[model samples]
Target: MEALRVIVDPPAADGGRRVWVGHETVGLAYCRADVLDFLRRAGLDPERVRLEDAEQIEWHGGGPGSWGARE
Candidate 1:
């Protein structure tokens, strides 16, 4: 098993995904911009970090497209 630095958990009942940076839970992101905001507040540069980067983001149940429940 490997430790995920940026983990985006499966969507919740409220159609939001839990964004985790390291061991801290940033917030529940409902959209791509929300996720970006979490990363920005975590000290990650938005210009350098991309949401499509698989190596940088670990998406669980579903990727960015799956926000309104697990598909």
Candidate 2:
């Protein structure tokens, strides 16, 4: 599976603190609902969170030699 990063910031009512997503800045509205839900469940604020690498790493599991089989 692939992943994408989006910075998040706290809402004005919550003091509106600056949040970083690996040095990048993002708005609160862009945050995902599922992420916010998890944060709330974990007693964390979604605004001050950083999303892991926006870029995806190549999966080499399907390539030759990956399965450890003999030719």
Candidate 3:
């Protein structure tokens, strides 16, 4: 089974942390409990998904001011 990666992004426009699953925006979570709840609602096992800090991920969008962009 391919490991699912859950990237935690910085707080977005909604003032809540954005969670990403493979370039798809799962949802915005205000806290750890909220994030877990979202995972459960998405039919994903919270324990199985590899949670990653946004800073550690290399931005593939490729543009100025992109998250994780290399200068």
| Candidate 3 local distance difference test against the native | 0.55
Tens-place lDDT digits, model 2, residues 1-71:
32333333333343232333334433232223544554444444556543342331111222111222222
TM-score between model 1 and native: 0.86
* TM-scores vs. true structure, each candidate: 0.86, 0.26, 0.55
- Pick by TM-score: 1 or 3, better one: 1
Winning candidate number (lDDT): 1
Candidate 1: tens digits of C-alpha lDDT, residues 1-71:
55448999988897899999999999999998899999999988767777887899999978788887533
Weakest 10 consecutive residues of candidate 1 by summed lDDT = 62-71
Error of 3 at 68 (Å): 19
Q: Clash totals for all models, in order?
A: 0, 0, 0
Per-residue error at 24 for model 3, in Å? 1.0
Segments of candidate 1 deviating more than 4 angstroms = 1-4, 69-71
lDDT of 2 at 43: 44
Worst 10 residues of 3 by lDDT: 62-71
User: Residue 29: error of model 2 in Å?
Assistant: 18
lDDT of 3 by residue, 1-71 (tens): 76456566665554466666666878866655667777777678767643344442332332113333122
lDDT of 1: 0.86
Model 1 pairs in collision: none
Which portions of model 3 show Cα errors greater than 4 Å? 47-71
